[model samples]
Target: MLVALGQLAAAVVVAVGVAVVSLLAIARVEWPAFPSSSAR
Candidate 1:
């Protein structure tokens, strides 16, 4: 029982970490500079 609970907690932590990282990555790449590059 304890092992299952530990696995569940670990999975939740990993998922949340991945989600936050993905959001940060997208926010980093989605910049106004992209439009400037197109005009060039």
Candidate 2:
């Protein structure tokens, strides 16, 4: 039971980390478009 709990916690942490990284990556990818779009 303890092992399962530990695994669950690890999974949750990994998921959160991945989500944060992906969001940052997506923002980085889209960030350049904003400036040119507003210039139009």
Candidate 3:
């Protein structure tokens, strides 16, 4: 039971980290478009 709980906690942490990284990557990808869109 303890091992299962530990695995779940680790998985959650990893998932959160991946989500944050992907969000940052997406932000960077769309960042250039933001300025050009406003310029138009």
Per residue, candidate 3 scores C-alpha lDDT tens digits across 1-40 of 9999999999999999999999888766776657875457
lDDT of each: 0.85, 0.85, 0.86
Model 3 residue 33 CA deviation in Å: 9.3
Candidate 3, lDDT over the whole model: 0.86
lDDT of 1 by residue, 1-38 (tens): 99999999999999999999998886778767567644
Model 1 misplaced regions, further than 4 Å: 31-40
Enumerate residue pairs that collide in model 3. Answer: none
Ranking by TM-score: 1, 2, 3
TM-score of each predicted structure versus truth: 0.73, 0.71, 0.70
Off by over 4 Å in 2: 31-40
- Best-to-worst ranking by lDDT: 3, 2, 1
Between candidates 2 and 3, the lDDT winner: 3
Greater-TM-score candidate between 1 and 2: 1
lDDT per residue as tens, model 2, 1-40: 9999999999999999999999888766776657774456
Best candidate, TM-score:
1
